[model samples]
Target: MILPIVAYGAQILRAEAKDITPDYPDLKELLESMWETMYYSQGVGIAAPQVNKPIRIFLVDTAQVFERMDDEEKEEYDDDPGIKRVFINAHVQSLDGDEWAYNEGCLSIPKIREDVLRPEEITLSYVDENFEPHTETFSGLTARVIQHEYDHIDGKLFIDYLKPLRRKLLKAKLDDISKGKVSVDYKMTFPK
Candidate 1:
């Protein structure tokens, strides 16, 4: 099933998510639904909170980004092959390298994109969908995708990184999104 993504102003989107146990009910089913919803929304990453579940779970798939890149762009990220994986009960072990800017957008905040600055590499420890633990380091666009999803679980949004003046300028558009006035191809559940 493709769960309805919670919109930007939903309280759940601003709350820090909790970790889930291995015995969490219907774990496999939930992951399947999340994956379906993410692809349906044309998003490279989706956190549990985006689907209105306050749990420390998220998915990242950067293969499409790399696949769509031109030959020159591919060579630029020669070391980053991209990844498609689930991250559960994740914690950032370290954020290394310099900060870089990327135009980022969210599934919940449709039609709004901003240049967000984040670290170039991140080392994370997380469990797979099966609850097996693993620690991995990601860089380049892969790292950016992970960082974005990771922020959702931490109760942070890309817009939060914007300057105060810029945020003020976008208040109207943000309000429109909160009130379900924005147009998007995917399904969303707006705040009450």
Candidate 2:
């Protein structure tokens, strides 16, 4: 089932997520629902926080995009783009390189976008659907998306990385969002 995604100003998005346990009932079903929700929302990634579930779990699938591209196109893409990795109780083992900034957005935050600085690559570990432990290295856009979603589980938002000037300009908008003064428009281009 495709669950309704929690929008900006939802308290769950601000609260840190709890770790998932192996014995949790319906774990498999929950992951399926998450994938459905993400696909229905036309998102490349979806975190538990975005679904109002404060749990350390998220999904990413960019396979379709890469699979359709030719060899030259794939070669032009320096990073791995074919894997759909799911993370449960995941943690970043290390970060590499100097701070790099990218325009970041979130499914929870809707249309808002901000320049957030993060590592160019990250090493992370997590459990798969079968409760099997796994670890992988990620870089480029994949790393950026992972870091952004990972932060959500820690009660962090991309706007938290905004500079003083940017924050000031967005203060009213954010305030309005938090107070329910504004509405969520589905057409808004998010993760800007």
List ranges where model 1 is wrong by over 4 Å.
Answer: none
lDDT accuracy of residue 160 in candidate 1:
98
| Cα-lDDT of candidate 1 | 0.93
Q: Model 1 TM-score?
A: 0.98
* lDDT score, candidate 2: 0.77
lDDT, candidate 2, 96-122, per-residue tens: 976787777666666678788998888
lDDT of 1 by residue, 77-184 (tens): 634568899999999999998998999999999999999999989999999988899999999999999999999999999999999999999999999999999889
Q: Give lDDT per model, in order.
A: 0.93, 0.77
Clashes of each: 0, 1
User: Which ranges of candidate 2 are over 4 A from the true structure?
Assistant: 65-77, 179-192
Measured by lDDT, the strongest candidate is: 1
Report the Cα RMSD per candidate: 0.9, 3.9
